[model samples]
Structures are given as C-alpha cells and as structure tokens.
Target: MPDHLSPDPLHILHEVFGYDQFRGPQQAIIEHVTAGGDALVLMPTGGGKSLCYQIPAIARQRAGYGVSIVVSPLIALMHDQVGALHEAGVEAAFLNSTLSFDEAADVERRLARGQITMLYAAPERLTTPRFLSLLDGLLSRGQLALFAIDEAHCVSQWGHDFRPEYRGLTVLHERYPGVPRIALTATADALTRTDIVERLQLEEAGRFVSSFDRPNIRYAIVEKKDVTTQLLRFIEAEHAGDAGVVYCQSRKRVEELAATLAGAGINALPYHAGLDAKLRQQHQDRFLREEGIVMVATIAFGMGIDKPDVRFVAHVDMPKNIEGYYQETGRAGRDGEPADAWMAYGLQDVVNQARMIDESPAGDEFKQVMRGKLDALLALAEATDCRRVRLLGYFGEHAVPCGNCDNCLHPPELWDGTETARKLLSTIYWIKKQNGIGFGAGHIMDIVRGKKTDKVAQYRHDTLSTFGLCAESSEAQLRGVLRQLIATGALHVDAAAFNTLQLTDGSRAVLKGEVPVRLRASVSAPAARKPRAGRREAKAASPAAATLDAAGLGRFAALKAWRAEVAREHNLPAYVIFHDATLAAIAERAPQSLDDLQGVSGLGVKKLEAYGADVVRVCRGPHG
Candidate 1:
C-alpha cells in the first residue's frame, strides 16, 4: 500500500494530493464524510470541490472500508479524473462505455479483490442491474466505502443542466444506507439547492456552502457591437496565446464563428452536438491536450471539464439564465490566477433568450422560474455597481464591491431615462392600439430615433404623433433602456409574433410616471486596446510568471517544455501531469535536490519519484 493512503485526511491531502493545506471547508467536509456522515457540498469551480470527496476516499479506503464509487456526469471528466489519480499513485479506475468488455471485467475482478481506491461511472451505467450486482458484491466484501455524486444540481429539474438520469441516483442513498454519500455541485441557486437536497434524499446530510465569488475572474459585459471584432480584440489585447472558450447560442453560429476565428489566425475549433460523435471527441481531445486552442462551442461543451488553465470564457450570445451563466463563466481561471469572464450581449440576446422561455413546452410555473432567473442575469449585465455583488446576490450570498470586476474598475455612469422610456413604451402602446399589432425592437427603435427606412415607411408610422419623439436619444442609449424595461417586466417579448414588443401590466407604472427608469449610459469601447491584467487584483497570464526573475523565466520555460513532452508520451493534458503553478514554484525556488523539491507545493511522493530528478536537472542549467 502507498504511504499516503491512511485514515488521516490531512496526511492523504499533503502526501498524495500534494497540497500544503486545505481551503475553506475542505478539511471539515472530508473529516465529516470520512467519519461516516453524509454531506452536500456547494463549492465553486476551481475551488477544490473535488478534494472534499477525494481526500475522504483515500482515508476511508485505507481504513479498510472499500472502493469509493464516484458518479460523474461526463465521460471526459471520468477519463481525466482517473488519469490524474493514477499520476498521484492512487489506484483509480472508471467503468464507462469506452472500456472494452474484457477490460471492464478485469476492473471488476480487481474491484472484487479490493484493489481499487476510487471508481467512477455515469449514473445510467451505475443504475443498471449488472452494475448493481457488482456493487452488491463489493458491499458484501466490505469494499464499498462511499458514494460521490458530482454535478449534483443535475438531479433537479429546476437547474439549467438537468439530467433525467441523475434522478436515478437516489438509489445510492436507498440501497447503501450505511455508506456515506456526498452530493456536489459548483452552481446552484436557492431553489436548485433545495431540489437537490429533496430529490437526492439528502435531507439528513450536512450542508457545506462556500462563497460563489471568483474574484480572480474579471467580469465584463459589453453592449454587443460587432461581437466578432470585439471578441477578437479582447483576446488579442488581453489573452493572446491563452486557451479560452467562446460560447454561442446556436450550432450554426458556433461553426461560423469558429471558422471566422480560425481565418483571423487563431487556433479555433468548433464543438456542438450536431457534429459526429467521433469528431466531437477528437475536438475535445485536442482542446484538452493542446495549449492555446480556442473552443468555439454551444452550451454542450463545458459541463464537467476540469481544465485548470483556461484564461477566459467569452460569450458571443447571452445564456438563458443566471445559473447557466454563472456555471459557464466559472470555467475560467481555475488556477486561481487572473482570468476574464467577457460577454457581449445586446437587445437581440435578451429577445432570443426571452423568446425561448416563452416558447418552451414546460409548465407555467417552470416558465415563471426560468423568467425570474433570466431577469436576474439581465440585471447583472445592466448593473452599474459591482457586478460581483449582483452575481453573488442572485445565489443569496452577499459581498462588498469586488474591486476586480469591470464595473467596479470603470464605474459606469447611470443616466435617468424616465422620459425616454415613456416615449419608447408609448410607441409600443400606440402601435399595438392603432394597428392592433406589436412591432419588433428594430422598428420601434427606428420610430423612436426618427429613422424612416423602407420598413418604417411601409408601416406608415411616420404619421403617428409619437414618431421620432426621442430623436435626441441615440439608438444605443434607447436599446440599453429597452433591455432594462424588459428586465423589469415593463415590456414583454411576444415570441409568437416575430419577437415583437408588447406592454406588460408593469408598463403602466412607467407610462404613468409612477416609476423612474435608470439606465447605464452608452460608453464607447476604447479604440486602442491595452492589457487590463496590470490593474489591481488582476493576475498575469499564468501564476507567478510576471514576478519571476530572468533566470526563473528561462527555467520555467524549460520545465514547461519538458512537461509537454512527458504529457504527449503519456497521452494526458500537461496540467494533469504537472500544473503551471507547480512548475512555476519549482522554477522560482530553483530546487537543487530531491529533499529541496519536497518542500514545494504540489509535489507528492509519486510525482517526486516520477519527475523530481529531471526537475532538479532542469533547474541546474544546461551544463549540469
């Protein structure tokens, strides 16, 4: 048995996982679960949520309990997680469709012999009778240690990433009542959290909720203006040569934008479910293994990815709601380094999102909940105060202005647009009243701005008394005003009627001047782009790169190159073998011996045995 495996959480954490200490509630959660207590953990992505269960698995297994079963949602997630554990010298295996029949049987034989520490599988496979029997065998042999359900929010229909298969996971609690189970998710609002607890039958479980704030990720939502150009500029100025994910709303848009990005000399790849499964896997593999590859994808791409060096997450179109938005943007800056959550949304994004909700086949109650979530996201986007505060407040957590977000740094000016809003609403009200029809955003904006295009002339809206009433207001300003109105429920987007605007009952307040309308003034983006990472609380491209000396920089580069070659030989992501933080620490310290390497963080016994000598050689310079 490995020396790190024991009934000691801190010993396993440092000796196996190679971390110096626990963050937040990790130690507490691990100790609780290891002591046979059920838990529900809500830690943010990159917040070391995995450690909450992983440490317990090591401790419990060493205590002569049994193999821990981890119910993961994605095949990619399972593959990488198991690989990482193997690198740490822990015996972890995953049983998914990717394994051959004989290979799976071999794993089953080893599992029966109490050889594996942690085993990962999808919920669908785990719920099947054959796997259940195998689990029964393990239970009879005192080999079933615990159960870990990752992405626990999927069990709830209210969450954005609901999976019907996750509902079947209630069997874990019912069948293995004696085994402690921990349900984990990084993103869940109050309702989703409640639903997860209810559906998973974790009512008796201890709840561990960590702060949702990712202060290292700078939040910026720009008003959409040629999103492709803006995105390219943002990448070029801020994150050139860094890996990122760009999300679009549709499959067609994903492919087109990917091609366009590639044309602009970027290493971009498109990923969506519309593509062949083999091709999708290939793209995902390349994204995981290669550096500086931008993945232009839909919501389908980023569910359980554990890539830790993603520098940014850009959105060409807005997500449907706050949960989805929070989960998606949380993918960036997993290394605790400065990263960006950049998005470009405009009137169409709001309309498209609202239209999807209105047109969905869900029940009215579900639709109402979805709408409320969307409104919160819009409020975040339109907020002039701290974006971080607005985001965390949605999850029922409060915080002071994080001096890191774009809003906190720039301090957008808010203009009172009460009169302008009335004019815009009057156009909708009169058009619906006179013509018995609602008009979409374009025509209404045109009428308000006094632009007599071909559509406006054909509609014959020039003769209306409200036509061009707010000619002084720029189209951008009015569009901003329109977004706020929709967000506030003063206006509704009728999806059945070509996304036309109609006055809601809430509009009466604004029309009667009983409510004041405040809007974020339209500010032009800076023409000449400069790096924003130099600002306070922002980080460099990678951890500690900016602060390293010249010799340290050279040593860091050599270590990275060596790590890349080894990663290719092992067919794993470089970060999985050794993260940039670990390499940077090694370079900065210039460790001269194996004893010296042990003091650096992220250097466990197995890793030290595997690569410690090579790292020391790299640090000693070319002659050595």
Candidate 2:
C-alpha cells in the first residue's frame, strides 16, 4: 500500500480542526513538516494551504521545546491571524508597527521565556538586528522550532507582489541551520516556484504542490469597444451590492473609475500604494468588515486580506500576467459561494500591458518570460469553448467542463483556422524576408491587404509575393487572424531581441493541413450582433439598488435604511461601522447566546465584545 499513517499529528488534525480527513496532500505535507523536513507548498486560493503549516506548527510545538515563526507580508493580516490563533487558544503574538515599544518588549520577553508557541512578523521586522538577536538566543536555548514563510511568491522578482526584503531571508538558513523552513503561497507558476526556492535558499526543501483549479469561481472574458460602459453595466448587473474588486492597470484609471462609480452612487473606494497609508487602511478595513463596497485598485491591494465572502472580482484593465490575473480574480467567492470572475479586455489593453514590460528595467530574459505569460493570459481570454479548461491547462491540470464559468455554460462556435493561420504565418515570413526589420501589426496588415501605405511603400513591401494575398479580408479580420495565430503558438513574438515574428513547430502541421485549427469569433463582431444597450444597462442596478444584502437577494432593506441614516449623520459611506454582510448575518443568525454571537464569522472579538449587545438588541426588536 502507501507509506505509514496513523501518526499522532493526524489525530490532532481531527481533534483541533474538526476535520476527519485531509484534503489533497495535507497528510504527506504534515508528515514532512512534523518530521522537521522543510517544505515548499504551492496551492491555489481556498485550497486549505494554511492548515498545512498551522497544524505542523502546533504539532511540532507540542512535541518539544519548539516555536514556529511565521513571517507574513501585511500588518493587518497579522493582526487578524494572531487574533484568530488567540481565540483558538494558541499562544501567538505579532511584532509590527501596530504594537508599542513596551508591548513589543513584552512579546520578546515571552519568547525568551518559551511562553509563545507561534510568532508573526513582517519580513522587514524579521530581518532586523534585534529580531535576529532574539532568534539567535532562542536557537541557542533550543526553543526555535521552524520558520514558515507565508506569501512565498512575493520573493520572486517576476511575481506580482515582489518584495526586496524577501530576497534577504536567506540569512534565516545562515543563522539557524537546524530550523526547518516551510514556504507557502496560494498561487505560483514553475518560473515563480524556482525563483522562490533560489531566493529563499530552500534548495533541499520538499515541494508539495496542489492543484491550481478554483472550481467555485466562474470566469468570463468580454471584449468591449467602450470598456468603461461595459464595466459599469457588469458591476451594476452581476455584482451590484456584493463585495468585489476591480483591477486597473494604471493608478489614474483606478482613481477615475472609482470616482465614476461613486458619482453613479455606488459605494466604491480607490485602493493603491499611491494613496496615503491611512486612506488605504480605511478602504481595506471597510472592504473586510463591510459587504458590497467595491474597491477599485491597482496591483497593490488584496494580498492577504482574509475576508472570505467577496462575491465577484472584475478587471477593468488587463493584468500584467496570468499569475497576476489568477491571483486577482481568485480573491472572489472565497467562502465557497457563487462568484463571478469577469474582465473587459481589448486590443489596446494587450498592447499597453506588453508596453509596460517593454518599459521595465528588467533583463531581456525576464521581459521575454513576462511577455510569454501575458500572451498566455490573452489566449485564455480569447478562448471560446471552456475558459476554466484553458485556465487549468496552463498550470498542467485537467478539468471537466465547469458549468459555473461563462464559456462552459455557453460554449462558443469554433471556426476553422487553417487558412487564417497559414495566411498570417505567410505574412510574417514574407514581411521578414522583404524587410529585414520587423514591423508592428498595423504596418504588416497594411502590406498584406495591399493598402500601399507610406510606410509599406517606403519599404517596398507591396511587391512581395505574399502581399495582398488576404486582400479579401478586412483590416480587423486580418488583425484578428494574426492575433489568434500568435496566441495558439503558430506564431511567436520575440519582443526582446527584435520584436520579430517566428513560427513554432506546431505551425508546420497547420500549414500542411494535418491538424485542425479552430478559434472563437470576436464576441463583438458584426455577425454576432451587439447586446442591446438598453438590456445591458437594464441588467445593472440603479445606485439605490447597489446596496443590497450579503447574497444580493434583498433582505436588508431596513438595515440598509438604518445604515444610510447613520452614515448621513457621520457623513460616511454607510459602511464605516458595519458592513451589509455583517448586518445581514447578524440579522439572519440573531444569536441569543454570547457563544453563538462570538462564533459568527467576521464578527471579531473587538466587534463581538463591543457591539454584541447592541446588535442582539437590534435583531431582537425594531430599534435595536
């Protein structure tokens, strides 16, 4: 059969978490960690990755004089985590800017006395001399157990949330060679995984990678002519009152979109590192504690926020790479509920995203890799048959048709791409032969369609044998065909070396008519009639209707009314005190007992202890 089981740690998993069995690779991971072997865990969002480290920390702590040190990325996240650990009766403490000097000293005192089981700190704090000295002391006394790195992907320069301090964590090994290190991240690709290992010095660590599929999230990609209008319609219609995040490629766009949504009367907030720390904190707090408040942000927000009930995540601008898009969209529906992952992508979005990499100061290899990832994301966005299938395929996983996603629920008709791909590949080859220098799509299309443009004539490309071969097709059609060819690996873009177009081994089969190539027609094509403006707009809710209940099912009319009245008095956005979800949950689970109230999710100790009675009274009667 398999290796041994029935370890004492397995028993503790059932006893502490109320879970009888491990999901995916939990048993193997726990066994590895409990045995003091370092591990690098790569799992997707909502994949129970935290339990892999948390359970092992507890087990190893109980086994002997051990203390698990957790290095997190966010202060607010550390607070929530340490608080939860305290409620579970785990001796946990965090050192960050939030704590006073005396309080920090108290935690250090506890650590020296072997009174703390787990400690959380930011990477910046973890690398400090004082903290290292303390760790040195702990190591000497044989009280240090293991080092767990959360958000491990942040250590990679190619990752979306790269942090410079993370690269310095190699000292953890140099300082304490005996402490086991477990690095964990919810999303990472092969390239990112390698970077994580190299940067963290986890050369000898075991890797536990779980499946990257998020079946509960429904993915949809819509190509739009007027992106702002489509985004408004989507937010208004699909995720009106439910909590969601809107990602923008630019800080200016983030601000403008947030303002536009607010002008339209939606409770939308802008979040980016450019904003003041206080404002960012305020927006983050509202997003976590309140429900239905949309946060329009750049890549800075939503790293480790534990608010699990985000109903949807929308992308107003295309993300930098697939990993980024995956992590951003994965933030939605984390509570195992129905959630929508929607995006409005266009040709300009693709160009702008590529241009961003082109402008970066990174090496040529890094930029090329980044472009490859971007192209992959674009291909997935342009796929018609099954979005989920294409998404999981990138991470090397198979999936049945996920009925929740847009394409699986509404499969698109595929067109034969043999002639189209051959025509495009011929154009690229003909252009390269005719003019040694590469040209962008517009100029290349002009030459192919016999436009006789000034640039095309200047290069004498009109006389090429393959010129005007696709003159029957419109400019948009030819462009679409070229894009599809590039996306499907029949054509490749070499942006770093010379921005040249080259064909892969797969393109030869297509040229020989040996393989059937198909692609989804543009959703906004003339043949595919545009969705009625009135209907699209009608799908969206009015400003008044955007503030609904947790499920967006309209049970919080009175609660919203009360919030509006209170907000007007305080001149706030009805979410400063309590979120709609919190209120609706309070309304639904009108806990008569203190234990019941404390058990309510999102109702942390501060809220439960401060406003528990008031909330109970409100749920008990009309005036409460």
Candidate 3:
C-alpha cells in the first residue's frame, strides 16, 4: 500500500494530496468526519470542499472501515473526480447510468471484495432496490464506511438547482443508522443549508460554514451597449487564448453568441439542452481535455464542471437570481488563480426576468420568493457601494471592500438624483391617471427625453407637466437612474402589466424630498480602439497575475506545456493532472530533485514519482 493509505488523515493529506497544511475548516471537518461524526459543510466553490470528505473517506478506509459511498448528482463530476483520485494512487470508482451493466457489476464485485476505497453513485441509482440490496449486504458484513451527499443544496426547493431526487437521500441515514453522513454544497444560503440538514436527516451533523468569498475573482458589471461588441472586447482584451464559460439567458442566444465568437477566431462551442446528448458530451469533453476552448452555454453547462483553470465567466445576459449568478461565476478561478466574473446587464434583463417569473405556473408564494431573489440581484448590480459587500451581505455574511471588483477599482461617484427620481415617479403616476394603465420604460424615457414620438403625440401627454422634465439627461443616463431607483425600491416593475414601471409605496418619500436618492454616475464610454500590448498587458491588468515575474512566467509556461502533453496522453483535463497553482509553485521553487519537489504543494507521492523528474528538468531549462 502507498504511504498515504496509512490510518492517518494528516498522512493522507501530505502523502496523497501533497499539501503541507489544511485550509480554513478542512482539518476540523476531516477529523470530525473520520471520528464517525456527521457534518454539514457549506464551503464556497474551489474552497477545498472535496478534501473535507475525501480525506475522511480515505482515513476511514485505512481504519478498517468499508468503502465510502458518495452520492453525487453529475456523472461528469464523478468521472473527473475519480480520474484525479486515481492519479493520486487512490482506489476510487463511480456507479452511474453511464456505466454498462457489466462494468457496474465489476465495480460491485470490487466493492464486495474490499478492493475499492471510495464509490460514487448518483442519488437516483443509490435509492434503487438493486443498489439498496447491495448496500444492505455490505452493511450486514460491516463493510460500509460512511455516506457523503454532495451538492446538498439540491434538497431545497428554493435553491437554484433543486433536484427532487435529493429529497429521498434520508433513506441512507435510516437504513444505515450508525454510518456517519456528511452533506456538502458549494452554494447555499441559510435557508438552503437548513433544508439540506432536514432533508438529509442530518440534524445532528456538525455545521462547518466558511466565508462565501472568492477574492480571487474580480466582479464586474457593465451596462449592456452593443452586447456582442462588449463581449468581444472583454475577450480580446483580457481572456484571449484562455479557457472560459460564457452564459446566455436562452438557447438561441447561446447558439448565436457561440457562432459570433467562433467567427471572431475564438475556439468557442455552444452547449444547451437542445443539443444532442452525444454532442453535448463531446463539447464538454473537448472543453475539459483541450486548452483555450470557450464553452458558450446557458445555465445547463456549468453545474457539474470540475475544470479549475477557467480564466473568466461572462454573462451576456443577467441571471434570474444572485445564487445562480454566484454559482455560475464560481466555476471560474477554481484553482485560486485570478479570474473574472463579468456581466453585461440592462433594464431589459430585469423586464425579461420579471416576465419569466410572472408567466411561470408556480404558486404565488414561490413567485414572491423568486421575485425577492431577483430584486436582490438587481440591487447588487446597481449598487454604488462595494459589490462584494452587497453580495456577501445577501448570504448573511459581512465583508469590507475587496478592492478587486469594478466598484472598488473605479469607485462610482454618488450623484444626488432626488430631483431626477421625483420627476420619473411623477411621470409614472400621471400616466396612470391619464390612461389608468402603466407604461414600459421606453415610452416613459421618450416622454422624459422630450422625444415627442407617435405614442407621446397619440397620448397627448405633451400637455403633462412631468413630460420632458429631464431633457438634459441622455436616454442611457435616464435608464441607469431608473434601474437604480427600481433597485432601491423607489420604483417597481409591475409584472402583471407587461412589466410596466410603477411607483412603489416607498416612492412617496423620494417624491416628497424626504429621501435622498444617490445613484452611480454614468461611466464614460471607452475609446473606439484599445491599445494592443500583447500578453504582458493582459497579465499586468489582472490582479491575479501580480505574483508572476518574467522568469516565473517562463517557468510557468514550460510547466504548462508539460502538463498539456501529459493531459493529452491521458485524455484528461490539464487541471486534472495538476492545477495551475501547483504548476506556479513548482515554477517559483524550481525544484531540482524528487526530494525538493515533494516540498511543493499538490505534488503527492504518486505525482512526484510520475512527473517529478520531468518537472525538475523543465524548471532547470536548457541553460541550466
């Protein structure tokens, strides 16, 4: 057996995972779970959540416990995780619908003979009678180690990616009374966390809540203007020749955007539910195994992606809620490298989202909850304060200015818009009085800008006192102000009225001058052409790349080349071989031998034996 197979969590961490120390609550969670204690872990994505359960499972196995059964929702995630574990010289297998009956039987045989240390299965499969019978046999022989429920937030109906099958997971606890259970989720609010505990029947589990902050990712939200142009500019400026995910609101938009990127010479592919299963799998596989491929997709593309080096996640349209946005953006910078969460939103996004909620067949209570969530996201986008602070605050946490997001980098000046807000509110009220109906932003903006269009003339609203009150402001500026007002609760979009703008009860305060409305100043438009300074400009512009020097960059490039070659040989993602963080550490340290290489983080005994010499040679270079 390998040294990591020792009956010690610390040994497993060092020898199998090649880390010198645990991060955040990893050690405590691991120790608790290994001691037969149930745990509910709410760590952010890329925060080492996997180690909390993986280390414990390995330790339990070494302590004469049976194979750890991990319940996962995604077959791709299981496959990627199992591949990484095998590279670390650990025995792991997955049982999912993707496996043929004979292949699944072989895995079952291995589990029965104590050949596998960890087994991953989809929740639907785990709850089946045949699988339950297998588990019963294992339990009868005392071969069950523990149970781990991943993506535990799926148990909550209110969560972004609720899966009904997750509710049936309590069967594990009921069937195997003594087996410890640990539920893990990358994105969960307080409500979702409670739901996980209740649904998984892990009320007694220890709660390990980490901060929901991804400081490595820079958050940026820009007003949508020529969306394709903006998106192309962002890609060309910062993320050219890098792996990323671009999220769109609809399948048609995803397809269109993917084609646009491809026409611009970007290696982009579209993914959605509309695609054939084989095509989707092939695209996902290429994204994983190849470098610098961008996946243009809707929300369906990112739930189970384990790729860690994605440099950016761009949203061509707004998400319905903050949780969905956070989860999608969390897919980037998983390796602790600098990544970007860039979004382009406009007033239309809000109207479209409101329309979606109102048109849904869900109950009134669910609609209200969803509306509240969408409003919170809108507030975040329109916030003049720190974006990180506002975002974390929504999740019941507090944070100071991160200084990496757009808000912090270029602090928006607060312009008192009390008069502007009053004018807009009076217009909405007056329009209702005249026609007993609300008007969307376009007509309202036209009246405000004194455009005197056909609708304005037909309504004869040119006679209204509030019409053209703010002719000094441009259409874009007025739209920005209105978005902020809506976000601040001074105005609301009446979903039932075709998303017409309406004044809320709180609008009285602003109209009466009792409240001061401070809105973010409009950002100046960019120059027609941006300067081209090559990769150096890209690296220097990113906060995440501040750590690299010229020599380090050379070594990093060499290490990446080696990783790519190895990944090709194994038909695995480059990150699955070794994350960029590990490569950067190797480049910085320039390890000369196997002993020195062991000191680098993420280089376990298995990795050191397999690639230590090649890594050292790459570090030394030809001159050395």
Give me the candidate number with maximum TM-score.
Answer: 1
Superposing all C-alpha atoms, what RMSD in Å does each candidate have to the true structure?
2.1, 6.8, 3.2
The residue-level lDDT of candidate 3 at 170 comes to: 83
The predicted structure with the larger lDDT, 1 or 3, is: 1
lDDT of 2 by residue, 1-624 (tens): 112112366665654443457889988998898899999998888677777888888787777747889999998888777765654446889998988989999998998888888899999989999899999898888889889999999999878788999987899998888999999998888888899999888899999888888876778887656777778877776666667888887889999999999998788999988999998998987886665789999988888866666777988777877888899888986655557788877655665665678778989999889878988897887777678888888777788777656676566666676786676677767777766656677776776677888887788888887778778777656656666666666765555645556667867877877766666655542132223222213323222233444434233454456656655554343433454455656556655566656545445444555556655555555643
Q: What is the TM-score of each candidate against the true structure?
A: 0.96, 0.77, 0.92
Evaluated against the true structure, the overall lDDT of model 2 is: 0.74
TM-score of 2: 0.77
Better of 2 and 3 by TM-score: 3
Clashing pairs in 1: 66-143
Looking at candidate 1, what is the lDDT of residue 206? 97
Of the two candidates 2 and 3, the one with more favorable lDDT, higher being better, is: 3
Clashes of 1: 1
Clashes of 3: 0
Rank order (by lDDT, best first): 1, 3, 2
Task: List the global CA lDDT of all models.
Answer: 0.89, 0.74, 0.86
